[model samples]
Target: MTLDPQTLLAILAMAVATAATRIGGLVLFGFLTLDRRQKRAMEAIPPAVLMAVVAPTALATGPAETIAAAITALAALRLPLLAATALGVAAVAALRAMGL
Candidate 1:
């Protein structure tokens, strides 16, 4: 039911390591020259990561949740990310309130 200090520390360490690895690559890349192939791959990285993040979150709950999240994201693109997130959360809350 609860995470002990040791387990929590390990989890934190892993998170930091993963972040460092990703950032370290970018830092190192700046000092070096990326070839054409690498550059092309890098261009695709953003969309790939977007999909990687979005696909799972969309499917995590259900179609309604996914639709709500999509609407929130779309709103965030036009408005502030916080406001969009609030809208998405509000949509979910309203659905729950309505007993949907």
Candidate 2:
């Protein structure tokens, strides 16, 4: 099936809007002078957002994968963040490879 011009334009518009929303926040936040409280609040945002995303994913995957992911998160907490991410991804990939 082929998308007509209008359908393609609509899809492109949606993509642009999503991109604008994401990048616009960075631009706006960068220019604005945030107070100390606001800065602290922003600092907490990432981990909260990460957990918001991972929580449902962890729940859906069940106890074992959740445990593995938790261990990965904890390890990442202890070591370099990138290494932890790589280790966690490798663990998940290996589990899938072995048909876990």
Candidate 3:
């Protein structure tokens, strides 16, 4: 499928906008100094963002998803983050395959 000129321009605009935001954030932060509280808050941001993204899906979904989420949480407590995520995905795939 061919993209029209307007579509191409729009895509280029989006790419430019994304790059600008990313670079701007880094540049803005580079010259800043954070206090202890601010540093801690910055560290907390990632997990908070992750929970915000995952909580709704895990809470609203069916038994398979619930079970997978439980597995993910348990594994996360003991295992590395990537391993926990993989385990969660595997559990969900297995459960769905078994028609849970």
Each prediction's whole-model lDDT (CA): 0.73, 0.73, 0.82
Encode model 2's per-residue lDDT on 1-100: one tens digit a residue: 8879999999999999999999999899888998999897776565456556776887688555676577666765566555766777777777766666
Of the two candidates 1 and 3, the one with more favorable TM-score, higher being better, is 3
lDDT of 3 by residue, 2-75 (tens): 88999999999999999999899899989999999999777656545655677689878877888988887777
Give the poorly placed runs of model 2, Cα more than 4 Å off. 4-7, 35-40, 75-84, 94-100
Residues 56-79 of candidate 1: C-alpha lDDT, one tens digit per residue: 877697766777767765775566
Off by over 4 Å in 1: 1-9, 18-54
User: Model 2: clashing residue pairs?
Assistant: none
Better candidate by TM-score, 2 or 3: 3
Question: TM-scores, in order shown?
Answer: 0.49, 0.60, 0.63
**What's the C-alpha lDDT at position 38 in model 2?**
89
lDDT score of model 3? 0.82
Error of 2 at 10 (Å): 4.1
Clashes per model (N, Cα, C within 3 A): 0, 0, 0
lDDT, candidate 2, at 82: 59
Ranking by lDDT: 3, 1, 2
Model 3: clashing residue pairs? none
